[model samples]
Target: MTARERLRDYHAKRDFGRTGEPRGRGAAVGDEPRFVVQIHDASTLHFDFRLQVGDVLKSWSVPKGPSGDPRDKRLAVPTEDHPLEYEEYEGVIPAGEYGGGTVIVWDHGTFEPLSHDRKGRPVDFAESLDHGHATFRLHGEKLRGEYALTRFRTGKDESWLLVKGSADHARRQGTPDPRRARSVHSGRTLAQVAGNS
Candidate 1:
């Protein structure tokens, strides 16, 4: 198959995985399912975590940021998928970019959506989300397992809390900082990965 065809299949099959969006100049990437959760240490000092849900990536900008404590609920405000180029963005985003700040992929890894409602009946993605509980399993270097974010049906995008449900990955606040989170990438820190930014 041609390169474009290969990429299409890659995106189709590995639609959820996170890959470096080459910018300026870089190497060719592989084809595999990708799901990323970048703890971008931006100038604003907030963490940005994103996951490829379907076509467009699901995103969140967390301030005071991700606490490992399963009981501690962090605010996760949803946003749009920055162009794939954003995957590699670091340093300073010119003045017009969406976030426009120093970027750092604090932590990332592949994720799996957990199915079920509070009552434990196979819940659909849309249905669960509509009611304010999009639980899922995460297999990242830092965070993992049944997580939920109660979305405010009547409030603006500013209404959500990243909560952890009963799962294999649960701990205390800042117990596992993203900096300490082993990288799936080649021995490179998210900052180093985006350092060139």
Candidate 2:
């Protein structure tokens, strides 16, 4: 399906009139795969993880943010496809709206799929995601090196685990204490961002 068609649920959940979020009307397929992590201060604070595929961004709602330790498995609940422009979204959603809260661009970067074939060739990222597993190397200001997402058996399709992979570039930056993390875009804390909105 086209990216526009894939964002039906996203559009349906948000009202552009009340929120400043982009209407997502003109999405174009990007040349390279990108990744974004947005710290969303909704009723429940969580991190929105997104990966570019085709013209849409496959997303997940990570409750405790991401970790840099291979042993740390963060719970990731899959969400709807978001528009590519949504990667730059960092503001407030009005009260009573679907995801009424403040948002901050925690990290934005490009990534390369690390899944490989039996012959040791890189496998398609989309295909890896379809098979419920994907390993990638992220090149971001704060997060570097390999990470992985693995879908565990759950009756619902949304359950997945975000894990850090052992890589030379991977550091011991265990999950940022959410309380102390600041936005990469604005250098503001979640409370500061929320109060300003």
Candidate 3:
């Protein structure tokens, strides 16, 4: 499906008139692939993990955010494809709107596909995703090192598992707690970004 068609579900759920989020219309981006982890304080706090695939941002709602521990397999629920400009979105979504609450750009940067085929040949990222698995390395500010997203189940909505690479390389450094972490883009906490602080 085309990227614009892929965003149909996303647009259907949200009321642009009630939220400040950008409409998933034409978004100009560079050739480099991009990734973003958005801290969304909705009814419940969760991280919106997004990777630029094709012309839209393939998204997953990670409940526990991402960990620096390989043993920590975070649950990632597949969400709708978002626009590329959504990477810069950091504000409050009106109360009656879908996913209404504060949003912050937690981490964002370029990513490289780390998936390979049986013969150790590099596999296309889209192909890897189609096969229900994708391995990639993130070079974001708050998050670094390798990470993998594997579809563990398929039902009403798809569910995936987000895991870090190795324990040694997964160890987090400064600002160990993600809840207390500030936005890499604005240096503001969720509360501050929401204008509640």
Candidate 1: 10-residue stretch with minimal lDDT = 17-26
> Candidate 2: misplaced stretches above 4 Å?
27-29, 154-157
Candidate 3 deviant stretches above 4 angstroms: 172-179
Candidate 2 yields a Cα-based lDDT of 0.85
* TM-score for each predicted model, relative to the true structure: 0.65, 0.92, 0.92
Error of 2 at 190 (Å): 1.6
lDDT by residue for model 3 over 105-131, one digit each (tens)? 989999999899999999999999989
TM-score of 2: 0.92
The global C-alpha lDDT for each of the candidates, from Candidate 1 onward, is 0.55, 0.85, 0.86
Better of 1 and 2 by TM-score: 2
Which ranges in model 1 have alpha carbons more than 4 Å from their true place? 1-34, 41-43, 83-91, 117-119, 167-169, 175-197
Per-residue lDDT, model 1, residue 33, is 23
Every model's Cα RMSD, please?
7.8, 1.7, 2.1
